[model samples]
Structure formats: C-alpha cells, structure tokens
Target: MILKTYRWSFVVTAVGLVLAALYGLSAHLGIFQAIALVLILSVLEISLSFDNAVVNATILERMSDFWRKIFLSVGIIIAVFGMRLIFPIVLVSVTAGLGPIEVVQLALKGGNPEDPGTYGYELNQAHPTIAAFGGMFLLMLFLNFIFGEKEHHWLGPVERALEKVGKLEYVQVIVAGAVLLVVAETFATDHGRTVLASGLAGVVTYLLVNGLGELFNVEEHLDHGEHPEGAEAEASGSEGRKGPTGAAKATGKAAFFLFLYLEVLDASFSFDGVIGAFAITSDPVIIAIGLGVGAMYIRSMTVHLVEEGTLAQYPYLENGALWAIGALATILLLSIEIHIPEVVTGLIGLAFIVASLISSIRYNRAHPEAAHVETEATAQAG
Candidate 1:
C-alpha cells in the first residue's frame, strides 16, 4: 500500500537517476560520484521542503481531485522548469537589462560564471526583491492562521494571545502592514522602493487569491457563519432549488483559486530557497534533475497525507507548519540585509514540525480516542 501511494515518486527517481548517469558519462564524471550527487541533492531538497509538503497537504485536501491531478502534473512542470530553471533567468534578464535568451546563452557556455554578464552572478543579485514578496506572503499566511484559528491552540499562551487579538477586525492586515513597513525601513535602505513594491504586491496578491478561494469555499463560509442561522434554512432551500450544479460550480471555482494559491506558495518557497541549491553545484542540469526528483516526491507525499488522513490524525501538524512559515518569513525579511544559511532555515522549520508531531503523539497516547478537549499544556502535565 505504501509503495502504491508513492509509485509515481519512485518512477521519477528512476528516471532522474538514469539522466544523472547519462550526464555523468558524457561529462566523464564517475558513475558513483554522479549517483551520489543526485542522491545527496534529492535528500537536501526533500529535507528543506518537508514542511512545505505538510502545509500543502492541508490546503490540497480541500481541493477537488481534478485540481489535485493538475497540481501533480502541470504544477510539477512549473516547479521544475519554470521556477527552478527559467524564473531566475528572467530575473537576471531584467536585472542586467539583457534579453532572457542572452541570459540562457551565458549560462550554457564556458565563461567566467562570476562575471556580471553571466547568469550565475546576476541571478544571485535578484534574490532580495523575490525574498520581499515571498516573505510577506508567508508572514501573512502565518499571521492569518494563528489569529483566526481560536479553537486549536498548539503553543499554550502564544496561540491564545493571538486568537484574542484577532477578535478585532482586519487585525492580521494591520499587523502585516506594520511588519512590511518595518522590513522596508530597517532592512531595505539600499533598495527600499523595489522591496516595498514587491512586498506590497505579495500582500495584495495573497488577499485576492486567498479571499477568492475562501469566498467560494462553502465549508469556510459555513464555519465562519457567512450565512446566519436564521437565513441558513432559506439559503439551503434556495440551494436545493438550484441543485448540486450550483454548489459544484462554486466548488470548481474554489479549487481553481486554491490551485493558484498552491502555485504561488511553491514559487514563494522556491524563490528564496532554490537559489541556495546552486551552492552544491554550478551545473544547472544536475540541479534541475535532482531537485525535480525531490519535488515530485514532495507532491506525492502531500497526496498520500490527504488520502490517508494524516492531518486528521496529527492535527497539530498544521499548526507547526504555520509556525515554521512564520519563522521562515522573519528569516527571509532579515536575510535581505544579512546572510542566513539555508540549513539554518530548514532546521528551524523541521524542528517545529517534529516537535508538533511528538506533541500530537503524546496527546493521542494519553487520550486513546482523542477528543478536542485536550490542550498542549494539559497533555504535558499529564
């Protein structure tokens, strides 16, 4: 059953290994060395992206299967080629005032890669603005979750405090705006205009995409009492008159937006992090094949979690992922001015997720048939 669930990932692994081997033979690199490189990079990618997969699983479980399929297929292409290979090239083009074709040509030829004319050098310089956009979006993701989700408290006092503060309308927006301002003023003195603009774009993009998805999401509307009890019966009757077609249409729209959100989220994660992959090797082909294999597995892991109801079993997992996202956002915002190691970022996120999983296991063992009545503090005390 486990093999069945992850069969596609295995297929991708095999294909990547074969390509890695061919590249190695052509380049006169030892087969063992090439295989090792592929394996190492793939592991690195999965480790860095595990939290991402968990968070994605939460959102993806809500989407329709058709959309889910599209995510695995089309989304993989976007992630592997578009974001990983082409996005940075485009960034370099814009930054260097050269055509993207010229950027690609520079990357493929033998030259001083560190030269300003080369893709490698210019691509390194393009990270700050992308970080600004990604950081703000992730920050908003974390803030919105901790504030609005009052029922579940993962970290005793912090979650409770945020929930209370969230009672005020648009509190998340206000806090996010303040954070954006602080990052711009404190960290982005050199390129404040571009950073500020990118950050603002992230905020607005999140609002539009997330809002549309939520607006169309029936469960979300029901959970938040978008339709009052007095009018619920009327709405149900009206919906009944319209039949399943009406609800289905709304669901499809929601799924489409949800798919968009996932794509953006993937880009945000990749923009700041994938560049770090270059440190392992300057060979773009190896980076692409290795990371592509890892990405394929992450997508598979997400689907397996949804299909197997892992999130339901370990409810605190999502909370941990959000906390990690918050940490990542802070790091990204700070990283614009200073160097933050990728391993440090990955470790921080991994620690939160692992701690949350341990907490969940403890709660499950204590409660047997766990009720939502338990709190993290009480579980620890018990």
Candidate 2:
C-alpha cells in the first residue's frame, strides 16, 4: 500500500546520482561529490529516522487530508533547510567566529586528518560536547513520554482551562508574548541567541499557520461521508473510521504543538551531526552536503510513516521515538557543560530503535490473532 503511492519517489531516488547532480543545490560541492554525498547520507538518514517517522505517523494519522499534504511539503522544508542547513551554521558561529559560508569553503577544500589545524576547524573537537548534550536531553524526553503521565488536557482539565481562556480576545496574544519572554531568558548567550531565535520563529510559524488554518475552517473540507447508523453498521460491521470532527480538529492542534516541539528536538539532534561532520573535515560544504542529503531521507521517511500508519501497527516504534527524543535532549544540556562523542550516543539510540522495531515485527507475526483482538476493541470504542 505504501509502496504504490510513493513508488515514483523511490524509483527516482534509486537512480541517485543522475537526480542529485540535476537538482542538488549546494554551491560549493562538486557535482560528483554532491551525488555521492546525497546517496550516502540519504540512506543513513532514512535508516536512522524510521523510528521518528513511525512516531510522526501516529499523530498525523488523525490529521485531516488537507493538513497532511501541507505537513508533508512544509514539514520537509523545515527539516532539511531549517534544521540541517541553517542549524550547523548557527552552532559554529556561536561557539567560534566561524562564518557558515567560510566553514563550507573549508569543508570543500578538504585537508588531511592527521594535520589537525589545516582546515582550521575539526568536527571531532565538537563531537564530545554534542554527544554529551544529545544523550542526556534524549534521555529526559524518553522518560517523559514513557513514564510521565499526560493529563489528556483536551479531554479533562486542559479543556476546561482552554474553554475559559478561549472567551478572552487576547488569550492567544498573551500566550505568544509569554513564549517570547521565556525564549529571551533561556537563550541569552552570545553564541546561542541565533538558535534560540530560530526556535522561537518556528514556534510562531506553527501557531500562525495552524491557527489561521483552523480559523478559516480548512479542515472542514475533509469530513468523511456520513451514513445512516444502522445501514453503515450492516455494510461495515468490523472496520470503523475513527476520529470525527472535534477529534480531528483536536488532533490538528496536537500536530501543531508536536511540530514545534520536534523542531527543537531536531536542532538538538543536529548539534552532534554538525560537529561530528567537521571531524571528517572542517569543510562546511561537505558537512552541509552530507547532512543535507541525510535530512532529505529523514523527511521522506517521516512522510512515509505518516501515510502508512506504521505507529498504529507497531506501537513499540513510539517507545523508540521516545528514547530518541530523550537522547537528543540530553545532548543539548551536555554540550554546554561537558563533552561526549556523537558516535556513542548515535549508536546507543540506533540499537534501541532497531531492537524495538524488530520486536514489534516479531510479535505481530507471531500473534496476529491478539493484534486483531486489540484492533477490534479500539474499533468498538470509536
């Protein structure tokens, strides 16, 4: 089912070099090098992002069809350019006087590894801090998703509060103001202000896009056909379409918040990749090319997961995503205070996600009957 829809993308991507040389955007990278970098990084990023894709699918499953399309196109843009391209430059500029353009030039020049200062910057020197920050940050997020009980605010107290606030004309403005204040205080460092600014911009973007979308009733177009209660029951007794109007709208809200949260998560994830890529060479061009390609694959994978309902089919993927989030969060904090290697943190996270995916697949194959039972129960609730 998934393959049928995105088959063209897959096929064109498989041709690889021909496509990259034709469409690759980086100015500094050679044509052949760009092709090779895109192919390599795309595969790696896709593989690593499977868990993330699955998690995104769960939330997106409930979104209206129109919003899903927008999410796919816009979300990918944000992921590759916002996180991969712009983020590394932000990091380098803050910590050192290195301009992003200069870094890319250095990366393209390419120097010997043993001769440390030849490129004037080494991604390796930055990895330890990236790892330290990424690891701890992801750990905290994992715990929050798995053990931290969410209050289903829309269903309970949160809903009540929102209802009360909704009557106020300035509620949204107040919230936006508060968010800006918090951002200002949190990202006060000379070097990190850019990251903070970018993050804040993302938040504002999400709110405006989604809030206006909701106000204009964009999702109303996606309402499914209604059937007479008894007639519909006779035609489809077992399978039921869930997530009605209110639920779908609520899910849209959730997606907006989730996107905002994940951008921050993506920034943290990039910290290690950006710095680590430099270790390979201080050439910002290579780092950008490699990471940009990887990010493209990640974006593609995220859309695939959303389209396929992977998370609903395999719940354990959520657990893996939770862990990945935690690991990145940890890396964020550690980068400021200590140093750790990106390789170590990335490997640990890779292992957990792979194991969880394997386990989920195995369990489903072995106990198809049990899976059916659970699906039936959920259907009945809907």
Candidate 3:
C-alpha cells in the first residue's frame, strides 16, 4: 500500500536512473558511478527543496485538476530547461559569446575548454551579472514577505493607490511601462533605481501570473469570500444561476497563475543549486541528468502534496516555505559577491522543511479530525 501510495515517484525515479545509466554507458562512465551520480543528485535536490515543495503544495492543492497537470509537466520544463539549460548558456553568451556547447565543454575541461583538470570548480568565475540578479532577487523576496497581501491585511496607502490605478486597466500597463523605462534609464548608475525596478518587476510578475490564472479558469479551493464554502446554494439562489463546485473551480484561470507563480519561485530557488552542481561536475550531460532527475521528483512530490491537502491540514508549513524562500533569496543575493557553501544553504532550508513536516505530522495526530475523509473513505471501502 505504501508502495502504491508513492508509485508514481518510484516509477519516475526508476525511469531517470535508466536514462542516466544509458547516458553514462554511451559516455564510457562506469555504470555504478553514473547511477550513483543520478541517485545522489536526486536525493540532494529533494532534500534541499522540501520546503519549496510544501509551499507549492499548499497553492497547488487549491488549483483545479487541469492546472495541477500543467504544474507538473510545464513546471518541470521551465525548471529544467529554463534555469538549468537556458540561463547558464545565456550567461556564457552574454559574457564571452562562447557557444553554449563550447561553454559546456569549457566547464567540463576544468575552467578551460583546452585543459580538463586545470581549474576544478572553485576557480571558474561566475558572470558578474549574476551578482545583480541575486541581490535583486533577495531584496524583492524580503520586501514581498514584509509587504505581501496575505501577511499584511491592508495594502496601505501605496498599494491602495496602485489598486485604484489598477482598476483602470490600461493605467496599470502604462504605470508598469513607465516604471520599466525609468528603471532602465537609472539602473546603470543608481542603487535606488535598481531597487525600484526590481520591486516593480516582482510585483508586476505576480499580478501578471495571477491575472493569467484568472483568465485560464484555474480555480483554487480557497474559502475566499468571493466564493465562500457552504454559501454556494445561497449564492446560486440569489444570483439565479448555477455555481461551480469548489473542486471544479479549483483548476480554472486561477490555477494557471498559481502554476506560473510556483514555477517562477522554483526557478528562483534553483539558482544556487544550478551553480553549485557545476562545482560537483562540469559535465553538462551529467549536470543535466543529475539535476533534472531530482527536479522531476520534487515536481512529482509537490503534486502529491497538493493531492493530499497537506498545506490545508497544516498551515504552519506555509511559514516553512516562506522561510525557505527567504533563505534561498538571501543565499542567491550573497552568492553574487561571495561563494557560500551550497551544503550550508541546502541544510538550513532542508531543516526547515523537515521540521515543518514533523510539526504537520504532530498536528495531524493531535487533531485527527483533519483526517476525517481518509478515515471515512477507508471504512467505506473496507
């Protein structure tokens, strides 16, 4: 039964191992070594990203079925391809105009394409732009946590003004464009411009992602007053119209946005992992397989968390996710200027996730009422 419960994960892992083994065979790597690398990376990614999965699960659990599938499939694509593949290549191209293949070869040859053992991982210089990206990412996350709608009940005066402007539709776009233009003009020389641009980008991204969700019919199973639970009949009666089932609405436009936001966060969290993995090995093939395998499992696990309603059952886990986000954001920012150990960041983030999971288990045990559906389902089936 436990195997059945985790069957999809087991299957995906097995498939990844097989693929990794095949790749290793073609590359003349020892079979055991290749499989070992795959397994190690998989475990490492999963361990490091437990908190991310939990936070994602919370939002995912609320999304509709269609959106959940998209989250799993599309999320993996964006994660593996966008971050691990495209980003590094883009960085290399911008800095050196080296073809991505050549860059990968350079990374493999130990800091020089011509010398395989010359540099090891520590000697390679990460592009300078990475610093800006990391710094802005961390700052935005810090501000988001402090100023988020969920954390702060009121939007305050600024958000209120923005909200009023947002109500004008075209006005919001004009504001976003104007903000971008201003940032572009000043970002080169002024710290304040960079901060403002970063914040604006983050907020605009959030709104765009959510708006897309609303358009996609991705619904959340949230009890937000707009579609309050148990008030459906009254809503229908008063409106003289049919209302969607909570589950049915969970995957509409809202789910699409949720998926987008989750993917963005996942990519942000993976910046360190991608760079750190290069330290382990410069083999692009190896890095791709190893990190790709682990990311797949995390994505699957996130889906399981949603299906299980783990977040709704234990809200504190949300705090764990937020904590992990903050930690990753800080780590990313710091990585720009300093080379912090990936293990340190991974352990800290992993510890929070594990703690949150343990707390959730305790909470569930103490309040068995949360498991009512599982109990009743089992009893009826029995």
Instruction: Report, for every candidate in turn, its global Cα lDDT versus the true structure.
Output: 0.77, 0.51, 0.58
What lDDT tens digits, residue by residue, belong to model 3 across residues 78-125?
777777666766666545656667656655553432343332232234
For candidate 1, the lDDT comes to 0.77
TM per model?
A: 0.86, 0.59, 0.69
Among all candidates shown, the one with the greatest TM-score:
1
Error of 3 at 30 (Å): 2.4
The weakest ten consecutive residues by lDDT in model 2 span 241-250
Comparing 2 and 3 on TM-score, the stronger one: 3
lDDT for position 87 in model 2:
57
Output the TM-score of candidate 3.
0.69
Expressed as tens digits, the lDDT of each residue in 193-215 for candidate 1 is 77898999999999999988877
* Error at 287, model 2, angstroms: 3.3
Model 1 CA deviation exceeding 4 Å by range = 27-32, 110-115, 218-250, 371-382
